[model samples]
Target chain A: MKAATTSETAEREARRNRIRLMQGNEACAEGALAAGCRFFAGYPITPSSEIGEYLALHLPRVGGNFIQMEDEIASMAAIIGASLAGVKSMTATSGPGFSLKQENLGFACIAEIPCVVVNVMRGGPSTGLPTGPSQGDFMQARWGTHGDHPIVVLAPYSVREVFTETIRAFNLSESFRTPVILLMDEVLAHMREKVILPEPAECPAVDRLRPTGPPEAYLPYASDRDVSPLAPFGSGYRFHVTGLYHDETGFPTGSPAKIRQQMERLMGKMERGAGQIQRFELTGAVSGGSDPVDTLVVAYGSTARAAKHAVGEARQSKRSVALFRPVTLWPFPEAAIRQVSGSVRRVVVPEMSLGQLAGEVQKCIPPKAELRRVNRVDGIPIAPEEILDAIVA
Target chain B: MANRIEVRFSGSGGQGIILSGVILAEAAAIYDNKNAVQSQSYGPEARGGASKAEVIISDGDIDYPKATNIDILLALTQVACDKYTPDLKEGGVLIVDSQEVLAIPEGNFRAYSIPIFRLAQEKVGKRIVANIIALGALVGLTGVVSRKALEEAVLSRVPRGTEDLNLTALRAGFEEAERLQRAEA
Candidate 1:
């Protein structure tokens, strides 16, 4: 590629600095492209179709590929295959499609493929409220696939965070050699907000670690480090990839000892590196100053937007309240919540699902810290007033 | 008072209701350098069903992306007007199509019944620009966004060949709004 002229560079800089309005789904696509995601395979689904639509138009322009797969199942499988071919790959889906992708999602999990799956959650169980907003998939993101497999799930509330977090999802997946789930609710998926996106140079992309030793000596599933380096298929390194329990050399193993070792290594990589994967926000009365927070609101995804507003409303009336939002939903920010719970008298967890997140918070906070849940299964975004009512109650 | 204003555009689907909200938000955020968030809620149907789109523009950060306290409500159809009128804030502004929305619900707000669709059809020579006319009327009545900004936003959004017609429709809406204010005076 020829280098850009000075005027072109200046114009590009000018465009980069402007604050543009972006929808949450558009941001996800842009973030994926910026993060060097060169391949996308997704089946169209409501609330998530826009991501694939945008990628379909722009991916080819950036020298990337976007394929409309036959179904959600094939979409998941194609991305895994593309990733194994040394491409940063992604796929997006919503509730019913998320369920469809789970069996393959579990395959990606056990095989430890580095891919990003964006689940723009709508009301669920089966095709329930396709256009409505719901965080019904909150728990499903954690254990949707039937296994004690490791996973990383990141939830973002605003369009700007959607862009940044999608990039982070790619990074975490690449670094950890595991699939990362970018969970977005319908409200956040469709909402448009003013966002000044960072240039590609500002947010550096992370590539999957590759085998450095001779191809003949490479073990596809073996590592002394926390994350084993993966060699791309047809990179002169030949190895088997399978969902079954395998030894270090990548052949299926029947030994209980090797099975235990494989499971331990897979789960242990995420457990030991949980701290680096966690991202959260603490605002309003976080410090132990004179105005210490007595009421704590823990929320994530679209619900956190309302909780943030409610926290502001509570503080206006001279109430001690703060908002603790976990951007990284899985590998729950337990230590931070426990520390904050020590200071607060009451803890409120608001989410779109009935006590999905609240149940998790209950386990983290102290028993004496009165836990209140403000939940909605009606497919409407939780209002700030509802959270405020919970705060004062 | 918080430096935030919530506006809602309600009409049947395929009437550019969501586009009106998006254009307003883009004008506020891109041209006016203000914070804006736009969201919409609609049924599965792509057309005919009542659709509502909301934009919250603020001098500060906008939390809670949806409209809670609507300062301005634009209803292009009677169904939309009936469904959403209850959410308008006290002393808010309600703009509706004069022909379609005949029976306005009583509220503690100012109501302007403009022939939005007729103006787009008769004056602008196109019925599809009714949403642009409504957008112009919206800005003219409230000044939620600057006129120049709205024009720029509209031009950027509409197709390349139809800028002139859309601009004429926008001006027609603005003139209609000015006429209403003059009549009140």
Candidate 2:
């Protein structure tokens, strides 16, 4: 993928500032467009197929390129190649397709290339329920690629939230210089809602930091700076990128001291930027100076919506329930969760999967507050009534 | 305020069950300034399948977006009505095509049997717009959404040059609904 140097020119042609009824997948595509994504390569899969379809139809009109790759692995490779060419790129897929892209996802993580991978989660050990909703990929999203590489994952609950979060995903990927995962479940990917999209000019987007130094002086993996600024391939800066543990010069090396330095810096970028990437919403008593919340519900994606509604309904019935919605799923916002969970007696983690997120929440909160989990794997999105019942009972 | 209403549109595929649900949701959300979400049965949500599309409209943010306990059901087929009727809330409204669905199930929810598709074919000159006709009758019977909002919403989404036919079907649907309401009373 040759770098299209027309992202600025393309924005002039994009549909700007309009309120329209949009599905969640369409919102994600629109968000990618707003974030100046200029390249898309993906194979179609249920639920997530709409994202690729929407982009295929509209990307060219905005002067971006959308290719239907031979398979999911090629789709993943193509996006990384485009990103290296200095263009923002993305791919969308469901669980099985996502599983196929894992090797390249590991490649992108080890190489520290900026890109976005949208996984619209579905039931699966393997093609379990093609069109149904599932958060079963929560662990796979973070650890599926194999290795201890840092990643940023954002989950949006509403159509509007998905739009903004997609843009945030691209911005985070660019700023952090890592591939960011916009983790969506089948429910959010297929549901349609009214979204008032902001004008293109109003969207805040970040381009990857580039090296301003002379080509000979460039160190692609240098840890002296907070982030190693990347220069586009064929842009007069000659550099080598390898998945192997490389020193600052982007070449392969096997020295223990050098490998440790590179890994720590790779990991430390997320550790230092966790505050910027961590986004969560605290609702109910946590929002006011009322009595301390006895139960704090920690949730994400579609489950969080049900949790929020349950908290609202419970508050009406004189229950001390609060909601902690993690807009950012990975680089798990443990500090914020811990803080809001301070006054609460217990933290309830509800998810479509069987205790994926709950296991992580359990590790963060003190033992003084019990950690409770409400899990379902029947491929049905968790109903709010179930959360409400859990809250009251 | 609990201005939340759940509406389900069920029929065979290609009848625009999903589109009609979206139109109803857009009318409430875009034109009437409400929070609305529409979702459909995922696996076989295509034409000729047992398809049902649902919309939840609320004055506030919606939680539990699916129509677990439907307040209104527009069943264009007997199969749709039979498969979906049990989930209707007590005192909810069930609107069915009287011509297509001969035996209506007895339930606590009020039932309105109107020949929605036949009326669309006879009055509007096209049976394909039956979903729009059913939508019109739905607005007329339940008043869940304003007729003006629904009209604008339909016009915005429907194919170009067919607005007048859809509009006619909508009006005829409203008339049939009014006639049924008077007869039932």
The reply for model 2, stretches above 4 Å from the true place, is A1-17, A287-290
Clashing pairs in model 1, backbone N/Cα/C closer than 3 A: none
Docking level for model 1: high
* Chain A TM-scores of all predicted models: 0.96, 0.94
A1-393 per-residue lDDT for model 2 (tens digits): 234647644654453226678899999999999999999999999879999999999999999999999999999999999999999999999999999999999889989999999999988889888878899999998899887898999999999889999999999999988999999998898899877787766778999989898899998889786588889998999999998889999899999999999999898999999989998888888723667889889889988888888888899999998898888888988888777777667778899999999999887777898777899988777888888888888
Best-fitting candidate, scored by DockQ: 1
Q: Which predicted model would earn the best lDDT?
A: 1
User: Each candidate's fnat, in order?
Assistant: 1.00, 0.73
lDDT of 2 by residue, B28-98 (tens): 98888788999887344565777778999998768778888889999989999998999999999999998
Candidate 2: C-alpha lDDT: 0.88
lDDT of 2 at B145: 91
Predictions in order: lDDT: 0.92, 0.88
Once model 1 is optimally superposed onto the true structure by TM-score, how far is the C-alpha of residue A129 displaced, in angstroms? 0.5
